[model samples]
Target: MNWGPPRTAHVTMTFDPEGLTRTQREGDACVACHKKWPRPRTRIGRLPDGTALFACPECADALLPQQDDTRSRPQRVAFF
Candidate 1:
């Protein structure tokens, strides 16, 4: 089986500005959950005109696959 990383170009994804709210477009709210407090800092993608997209850590994890948790950690082996 292929346990390889997800193939989605999540960070470089291009979003449609028309679908986003004014706060999201202005970087004031999360692009995923639309949360305003503790402003989302993780860059997920950009709009057609080059506007950066942001999402909360929780939402970001759901939207994109995590690399560090799966690839960097060594797998444990069982002994009989």
Candidate 2:
């Protein structure tokens, strides 16, 4: 009998801005990881101008940007 590779599960994630409690920037290390999401929540940071970024825990992992995926650039070819 052979043990196969572990199967990964697909999870649905949701984000609610109002649900997040205001947490100090220094208190969470996960703030840096949340920057990869398309929509990250803004919180007060230690500095006046700085901010603490946040996203739903589940969304954080799922929403992260994939490596080496290049976006299409518009071609600029002059037509005579």
Best by TM-score: 1
Candidate 1 TM-score, C-alpha based? 0.69
Query: Tens digits of per-residue lDDT for model 1 on 1-80?
Result: 64533342345878889889999998889998999999888778889898877888788788776665455767688975
Q: Could you give candidate 2's per-residue lDDT for residues 1-80 as a string of tens digits? A: 53522221123223333434344243343344534434443322223333434444554445544345388889898995
lDDT of each: 0.79, 0.39
Stretches of candidate 2 exceeding 4 Å from the true structure:
1-17, 24-50, 54-59, 69-80
Candidate maximizing lDDT:
1
Stretches of candidate 1 above 4 Å error? 1-10, 68-80
What lDDT score goes with residue 29 in model 1? 96
